[model samples]
Target chain A: MTAVLALLEFAPGTGATTGFRLVDPAQPHLTVTDLAATRGDGIFETARVVDGRVQALEAHLERLAQSARMLELPAPTLPLWRDAINAVAVALAAAGVADGSIKFVLTRGIEGGQVPTGWVLGLPSPDFTRERAEGIRIVLLDRGYRHDVAHTSPWLLAGAKTLSYAVNRAVLREAARRGADDALFVSSDGYLLEGAVSSLLLRVGSRLVTPRVDIGILAGTTQADVFNWAELQGFTTGYELLTPGDLATADAAWLVSSVRHAAPVRAVDGVERPIDAELTARINAALDGRID
Target chain B: MTAVLALLEFAPGTGATTGFRLVDPAQPHLTVTDLAATRGDGIFETARVVDGRVQALEAHLERLAQSARMLELPAPTLPLWRDAINAVAVALAAAGVADGSIKFVLTRGIEGGQVPTGWVLGLPSPDFTRERAEGIRIVLLDRGYRHDVAHTSPWLLAGAKTLSYAVNRAVLREAARRGADDALFVSSDGYLLEGAVSSLLLRVGSRLVTPRVDIGILAGTTQADVFNWAELQGFTTGYELLTPGDLATADAAWLVSSVRHAAPVRAVDGVERPIDAELTARINAALDGRID
Candidate 1:
């Protein structure tokens, strides 16, 4: 709504990036302050930008508000943020890329403040190989973050993306250090949580399953949408607690997210497995055959 | 060490002020970043400055590193950070304010890069209260931070100053909301963790006791130094797990920190009690009879 462009390298009104920028509450200025860069007090979302529209925008917006609530933050004004994001997408669209991932990060702005004003919008850095569709190797690592109320306690921002993501970054780094493409976070109790940047979805005997939300797993928007679409696609879906063994025995595995969509999990701990063609077909159908 | 000066109207390193400047890290230039106006982070410490020296500076350094570690950060180089702190202290001393508190804040720097880097520093603003020793009315709050993991997770950088301190700020606000001066954090299981900014110490019988490190309690430098001093004063000191009941029924209770070396807890949760005499004697003797 403000109609100011803080970052370039993308068109506006269509999400082509997987990043976000914060708006100053009082001014049109954008600043990266101590609130998030240092403390990681924020939330983020990644949604698809298809034909200048943020796909599943409402779900992403709702997730943002829920995340804010987990952090005990006042729910951000969705309409205003939407306008800001839309403006950036439109700008990016005009520049070149029309359809891509939109990364939105919301951080607690400034020092000593509770409300988040620090936001960033940008395309995700081009890192993941498009070959991920075939499958990617993921290594499991211990995050040491317990699932108790302190860490797992529901906050307006708990499931919401907060900027205190150093642990997530560290987890990813550790995974890479172990020669894996991505990291699967395991709770202190040895339960596989989720990937650092994506949600884990496994297919077992025609059932699409992921870890339950109560298991301290983030309520992933992409995974949720996939689940919803799965129901419509005549596939039985369930949310249940999962262990590595359960994942290992799955007919097929995949990590779901906004950018990667339904990238298949080809190998676990170097164990190669056959891809589940039927499940992939349903997921691709759910994506409307767009990911390629 | 980059020498720096803060222009403030109130006591040198105490209360929050509207704005302050730091000697620019890139050059000798001075730039003002108003932390008070920002409220970006919470729970800062200003240690005792004695005769152009920061008392137990290494301990404070250790605490700062520990805090950073808890927040899962790349440890700020001790010598460089210490140099900056000492520079500010030297500037303050030149302005003739030594033998007071040396302020330290762990704040997120300016935001905006893929990883933002905008750290700032300043001396205390006005309104700093230096009371020799005052009985404090304390309240206990449920911070939801795991007292065990939050208290003693070895990896969490416990006892270190971190920037994800909104909870600490919230605890103080909760205390103020309840008409208390400060707040104490208890685990979900009811173990007294520590004060919002300081560590907890109590005397059970003739032994000075605090929670052990593994209880998720912060390893308090001030308390540690006091324990060492207690040995000199012929008092047996031990660090063990403490619960609220243990605190309430203790022979005496005191909050230990850099500024408030040992403030007797007179009334906890409106249950008034007498001050612990032996605790006071050891504290006073440790301070060489000069508390204020």
Candidate 2:
């Protein structure tokens, strides 16, 4: 028998303990008619768990609310989400998980239903230790949109971070097929966007730069936290319109996300790029110190 | 208490009659862990049922297969899909639904599961009779991609009809807010693509023109069927790159889909356009005659 991936699960409004249900990951839970299942009409957030504590819980909750608003879904209360996450976190700790990830999802509910369906699941954090230690080889894939698309086309839901991530997943698969560890999506008109599962971060001398969120990319919480700490450490932080050329010329580049925190980009499109081991360490440490 | 929308639900492989389990639409049937509800990693098809017969059933199945291939999902055999559709059709007929729609979905299944989860649902066809009679007002919205996006970027999954339709749904909602009936998506480079929920068809002079499928648009099964029949009826059909101006100058325009057949466009962006009632009737007749 295969081991279940999800160690803990919680669904609100279900007749379970504390309005959260303990679900066996092996069984079917979601009906086939859910709008989330059928139309990908939903929002989700994945936050890291460290020593039984959810990292950047407030930030994740705020982003979730923003995503829900962008999807025109009724924003779920922070308390409801907090309680559910706590419930799942408790269960994960009880299962002896010291480090893991908690994923919260709010779907448009079943088709024809008015209320949204919200749930939280806790799973073991993926082993990104190697990437963090040795860095990653990435390829720049075209995201097929100009940088100004998000500003002109709001319906594209550019930065909303909805559940329609099949494209993102596919890009990573393509990267793997091409003998790369991950993919960094560049805009059609030659601008660096973000990564499939992480945000683009570049270090050039004492300056730290990331792409502007207004250019149709998700606002990376971890990137923001690292930038705040970097600024205090005498490193100038700025948001700019970057390109593939910018990535190739940078002293170092890293993909930053909540769970992995910061994974350095050691190469681009199979070409070996510069890697600042000390800088990567400092940034990861800064992220770790700030995220609570 | 409000009534549930789905009339009949069928999930294969569950212990039930005919490998399908009857579901109560009001209750939650999906677990919190299904990838379909979480990532929207799936493909779907909606086919019309006229007098208890699924129209364009083979075409829909073929498209579903194509979409699954694009998503790198294991395609289910035709016989399996046929059995599931037959089961749902029987259930719908038993419920006295002579004219309805059947929606079949194939999700990537749970987070770590290899087998895909498939289901069929039957619902009463929406009353598009009024729209088909009086026609519909449509707004031209930017799809935020160039016409060559699909050819240049396969990761965008442009031609594949996946479950990530939130943006499409949002476009229609925006159209409704703008006092329009539907939305026709124009490419970022000023080329007519397709409709939010249907394909774009225009009657210009003696020729019938539809946007080329290479323009990051789902190849319309209904449009293909209509064009095939139109050729036999002395109408020259061609695929070309079209613009909104072309739509404004056409003698008639339509948003065609399997369930609604062909709905004539009465206006584009609040500007009234000519509607050829005779042409619409003839085209719909052709579609009805060809689709089985």
Candidate 3:
């Protein structure tokens, strides 16, 4: 079993992850010149691997398929992608990772005949000392994405995990530039959107609320899970349009995602608030994990 | 020289371009995985190569460098890129391509350390046949790009040719969907923007007009050249804001770029028009032998 475990682990120089072959560890050969890179025409997803198994694997697969459908690209066969994702998870588990992260992606294949070349990438998980339910700091930035684009903008991947993330990365960079850890995108008309890469939730006194899907916010898998768990815990939940000021005035705030789980918000626009231990307790209880 | 050219024409399997050393072209490769595939974080330019030289080489390089700067990625050293472009042109010319198109690109390098990776890519000239300047059919679509974003949107490449071209491709696809060969993006407010892949130009009687730089249009190098030559030929030239109705009503319209040179707009929204022989004559005369 130990030898088998050693075989599965992907070291820096070994070059292979799971059964899916890797070209090289340093610089693998890839058909990158295709339309995917050239045109931003693809979709991707990240999954958490724990104890040699992928968490919420079905949800990630559904999202990947849905995103491809939205992009009008052919969706990858689920069995093949599942096999690939499992292999990476098993490999990481064999390498002494009791828990880690696995990233799965389906992209439009190389630029040629018709379909896009999809890819599945896996990486090691981060080391989390403990869940910091204490909260996080957020800055609001305008992405100028129109609200009505929920159904109109053909390129509105705002609700889907499309491969065109240059702007999302830029949003985070802008937040970092302003000395904030994360950014919450506000529409040009002042309505609150989602965070740079996470879904936003605010605690207005007793009821927890987030933007509705009609507002073009991504239907976050982790956010959904947290919402369900919150309901079970007897916490009231609602979806509503919000402004940045609404978040600033909230008694509790959290950014929810697969990797981050539930990250509580401590401040907005330089205004700090007391850490809501009760809210953190509820979120962590819902996530069944610690926020790293 | 043909033998030298043979060395430059890389087989698709080889993934090597004439000027650069592409040792690997598979996944996990620094050049492929980090820069080309993952983040969609790169920039590129497409221009024509004539004889043994790249057309408007300096202008393309300027745009490439500017895009790199806007993306916060390092610009490829101009001398190295210049040498690369030249070598590729030589190879193409040697391959019997007296007139052809060339694509030059730079991307964020491979992902490592703190920042994402960057890469540079080059491809052979496209096959373009010299036509009798019969115009193309154009359709107007809203691109959701604001006018002031021409200078205001920092994360946006604006006029810079960044890798996030999904919107551009979408416009072209929309045009094709509507049975047109190309499209001219109209602002939500109905002001004519640029073409999906070319600069917009109109001939209102004797005067040749294109959108001004303030209109959030790419300041086209070929259009500038045409304007300069048109001025030399005593043809009136001006820049103005054009509406979709105005474009449809123009005496003549054309899409200008390095590759297309000066393709005429034969129709807009199914409304047919006669090609302006005088305008075509002036464009051909202006562009003749200037590229090489």
Candidate 4:
């Protein structure tokens, strides 16, 4: 089997979790009326799994709950999700898949239906060895929102990692059209934001910096783990409101995600930039080591 | 059956239409990895059907093609779509449904797979007598983008009717929380944008106006029909850059959509506003009259 699928059932009215059922990942599971399929009305979290353990498990669950709160979906049951996640990770490990990802999604359910649809799907992670080794070429695109949109307009659903990622996909395609590997979104008002599917991390000498979490971006779980690991390695870490100038001046930069770990940004908008190859390899080693 | 579903199959490489298969709408037809469900990476067009004819069908198809161009999806074979759409509309009409909607969707297929996924679904329209006659209360929400985003950053997918509607759903929830029926969005730069799922039409005395299509809003098919019909009735029509202050001063206003037609705005942010009951009824009657 290439993937494992678990579906969650919710109790009526109280938003309490009833139970979960593991289903065939190959077969059809979602109806057309599912809000996730129709309106992109859902929240999701992807956690990397290694050696039968889900890395950054708590952080992923916490972020999922935070996203659920933002989208006003039923709050996810943490223990239930953690157990289901572990079950999927265990399945992957049993299949001899050393590295994979478990993506858990909680949608507002069928249109007008009372029950919400929740699922955890585990799939072997594709090899990102090249991206992690040689690094990635990136371009900065406008995110079409101000940096403070999360606070100024909560209804915009900024900072909430919802499934409405069409713009995110568009940016990646745009980057490809521009002959780049990935795209880092810059706010419309000239502040550095995050990547389409990852968080922007910068290294200046021994100090590591990432955009402030309060900005309109996801609080990246993997980035958080990298920061923790870097701190233990005698490096300082911080959250700051960064700009393109800061990124250009940094000693090294990366677009970090759970499955991909740390991918150094080797170029910006076709212009070659310095990459910390040794540090990137170390970060990936630490991520694969399952420090949690 | 409550709904009709037609799944479209495309020829390899050329994006030519091979055929369409009518399927069970109740069954799961899409994979878990379809880009539409995963990333909201799709475009859709919903047209109202009356007496076996889809209103503004050509306009909807053109807009769908336009959206496909913007999103870089396979250009929908227009005639195939027309036939499929008509077939679904005919199915609805044969089922004794006089009033209904045909929503056609074209998605980028399963992740990384070639050939797109296309579907046409026809469902009975909900009763909107209260919203049309009694009118709806509305609140203005910030859309989190400047009015010029479509031109400045086309990758934001602003003008395209993409499946990424989480924010659209969020704004409505916010409106309901504020004791309103609908939400109209304003650009972050203080210019008027469109509504969450409808187009805003205003009447400044003898003039009918809507926000310019170039200002990152959909070129509303229903509003276009309304304008053409109003011109026949000797009302001058135009597109202009507008603001909340302009909305405040308009003699009458409406939130018009494919399914609901023209719904007058009776209140704004809990404050009662003037609604042209006579004009609203006439407009709705004209719409139902199948002016096309």
Candidate 5:
């Protein structure tokens, strides 16, 4: 098998998911009416796999459950999902892949069916060496929402890792057209938000700062891991209502995600920015060395 | 078949889509990796089918092409799509369904496969008699975007009929929780926008008004048809930047869509609003009496 796939099966009567079954990754297992395919009405999380073990498994699952709650989907069985994720990770490792990523999805299910559709896909990871080491150039794009929207308009599904990411992908393309590797979304009212697919981490001297999570941004799993690593290394970690000026004045910055670990932001909107290579390497090392 | 399904096939060598092939609607056809299933990276258009003929056929096709352009998908061969849509509509008609609706989707395709995945699904229309004559209760929800977001941030894809509609679905749930039958989205700056799955149409005396299309709202196809019918009947029509005050002030209001036709707004945000029963019936009749 080129990749590992697991379909999470739920017991209709009791509303308890039994577990997952492995499937051929190449086969089509989704119907057209599945909300995940038709309306992007679902939630998902991707975690990196290393040495046959999933990294930050609990964190990813926690975020998945948070997203489910936001989307009003059935709460996923964490222990069962944890087992399934590990199984997919182990399967990829058995296939002799050193590094892989597994993405687990929980959808609203077939339209009108009410029973949720869920899956875990495991595939060998792409070489993100260039992104992790040399760093990524980012362009700031308007997210078109206020930073406080998550509190005011929860129906907008802000801060939820839902399947409706067409805008997220579109901004990346826009960033590329503007000669950047990635895009950081700035709230409409002028606040630094988050990356299109990752979380923004800034180093301002001895303090490690991320945009306040209340500002309608995902609570980044990798960013939290880095914060834990930073704390042990005697750095102060905090979240703040950051602005573009904060990004410009910060000593260094990076976009952190589960799959990519930590990618330093070398430039913003075409201007070269400082990269904390030593701290970056240490952060990645701590993340990569995770035994969980 | 309970429903009609048609999958479009593209000629890879020539970069031309030759035609479409019928498929069993019940079978699972979409792979997990398809961008539509993962990222909601797609566009769609729903059209009403009456007596085997698609209402506002050219209008729907034009909107589909317009959405493809906004999403940067390959320009669909409209004639091929037109034929497929008509075939699906005809098949559903042949199945003894008097009033059916067709939803055509164009996705960015499977991850890394530049080819687009497209299909037309035809299903019998739901009974909207209660919604049409009795009218619907609406709640105003903040859409979390400035009215000019479409012009300011095209990446956000306001005005495009994208499949990334989790928010669209979420707001309806919010509306339901508020004991309303439907929801009308308002811009962050408090300007009235459109419905979750339909367009807002207001009757101010004899003239018809819809939210200006430039403010990141879908230009309603049925609303356009109604305008044509209105002009023929000696009523003037226009587009304007409206507000909640407008909804309260208009002589009558309706959330117009393809499948549901004209659903009069008898209430807004728990407050009873005026309903022009005579005009509402005439408009629905005009929409239903379409020859094409």
Candidate 6:
């Protein structure tokens, strides 16, 4: 079993001194009525942490705020989250977790309480060296929504990062059952949306391409950072509607995310695709940095 | 704030005596790593309790089993759930809750633990007298899926009653913002699907109609029971593809669920619709019975 290394809980108006508490990871710490647990009524973010420092802290915080807004939640400010993240990161480091993951969660609180529950959890990162070095086999699954659904249906919460990820988890399970390592969701109309847990990126000639987020996909923060860094390295980026055929014909493809960084996709639906080791290393190098 | 009236925890292998424990509602009782809270990965059922007896107990249990199977969970046996439900229902009644609700929840459990967390929660039922007697105003909202989406994609959890209810809650909030009592979801192709929290039913001339469940909507247990009763009363029930205009022109329409039973639709999108008080009374009478 993967152990929860450290945890910190924060409730609004409790103040830093009394609100945050270091809790035993093995013990139960939430009420059964919490909406997050009962109804998946919440939002969350997971980021990579190294040597007590969190990577892309500002970006993760910004996305968390945006998700809170989309859910109509009164999100705790960035500084409050910063304090909680820093506290968890320090505790994890002191517990000897060098390279790990930090999760920021904001739940709708207990049923009808009208107060939000916020917390930070730190755990040792899963070793993705095999996926990063050997690459992964992915299957194409239909997400059952048209690309234009998000634009017209805001209540569907197309792009917001909510905790209602049962579908995403189910897709991954189905992929595993089909002998695939991961799954990339295709819209009902055959347009590529995103991976279950990461964003899809492809290299077509000199330009790097990704699916447009306006089509009801969560905007990948890691993909955004990589694109910005790639642009600085003289690479152009484009957001286009991609299809499975486009992915199969691309020079290279990768699943980009905050914790896993960039994992090369060696095959799509059992058909072998090109794996660009040079491009993979370049992307990882761009993401390599220390957070203060 | 709505207070949790009663709760009972049940885990497999603990036996009936050890497994069922009446818990204080105000305390924190779940681990922070519980997948139900973190990922909304679970299944739930809410049934009405009248005069210390649960209504439609067998039907709710069957649907709960179905949902658990869909989510790949190891569901507790019907006898076990019956024991827990009976225990909680008795305690709630002892606490003077005559007309209440009993909720059965089974979560994916704590991260890496692989054990399912099952519990029964008892709360006072919200009074729906006005909505039942005076009727409710509703609006049409797009569910962002085609009617055929469920047939092709089982991983989307089309008919499974999962805990990822963020979208449902969001739609209700949007409806409140628009000054409507509730919202009924329409498919991307303009077919009426179901309500966020209930099932849609309408009467057209001598025939009663509802959207087919194959279109990725949870099959409402109450709706099914009502249909069976209506059929016994010589009302023909037809599962057909319905549009917004069909609802507007219907002789009578209703949003039915276990707790609310059958609520008449007074209007849709601010346009008045016909309501059949006689039909509504008959439907309520059909559900007026106590469980053994």
DockQ list for all candidates: 0.14, 0.59, 0.38, 0.84, 0.92, 0.81
What's chain A's TM-score in each predicted model?
Answer: 0.81, 0.92, 0.85, 0.98, 0.98, 0.93
TM-score of 3: 0.86
**What does candidate 1 score in Cα RMSD to the true structure?**
8.4
Off by over 4 Å in 4: none
The CAPRI quality class of candidate 6 comes to: high
lDDT (0-100) at residue B83 of candidate 6?
76
* Native contact fraction (fnat) of model 3: 0.39
Report the alpha-carbon TM-score of model 5 versus the true structure.
Answer: 0.99
- TM-score ranking, high to low: 5, 4, 6, 2, 3, 1
State which docking tier applies to candidate 4.
Answer: high
lDDT digits (tens) for residues A241-287 of candidate 1: 67888888888888887766777877777777777755766675576
Error of 6 at B86 (Å): 1.4
Report the number of the highest-TM-score candidate.
5
Give the whole-model CA lDDT for all candidates, comma-separated.
0.59, 0.80, 0.66, 0.90, 0.92, 0.83
Quality of candidate 3's docking, in CAPRI categories? acceptable
At residue B136, candidate 3 shows an lDDT of 78
TM-score attained by model 2: 0.92
Clash pairs, candidate 5, are: none
B1-292: candidate 1 lDDT, tens digit per residue: 3224332212222322223345333232111122211223222345665445566778777776666555444444556556656656666677566545565554332221112122234333332233224556788765444555643333333455555454555566567766777778776566788887778888776688887766665678778887887787677988776788888898778777776667788788988877865556567557533322
Kindly report the interface RMSD of candidate 5, rounded to 1 decimal: 0.6
Instruction: List where candidate 2 sits over 4 angstroms from the true fold.
Output: A1-27, A289-291, B1-29, B289-291
Candidate 6, after superposition: displacement of residue B49 in Å? Answer: 0.4
Better of 4 and 6 by TM-score: 4
State the lDDT of candidate 2 residue by residue for A114-150, as single tens digits: 6566677888887888888799999999988788888
Query: DockQ order of candidates, best first?
Result: 5, 4, 6, 2, 3, 1
In order, the interface RMSDs are 8.5, 1.9, 3.3, 0.9, 0.6, 0.9
Candidate 3 lDDT by residue in tens digits, B1-292:
1222111122233223334443333333333345445567777777776686777889888877777776776545666677767866776677687766666655555555333333333344444344435567888776665666655556545676666666676667667888888888776556888887789888887788998777666778788888988888777998887787777788888888887778888888887887886668668666756854
lDDT for A170 in candidate 2 is: 87
Q: In model 4, what is chain B's TM-score?
A: 0.98
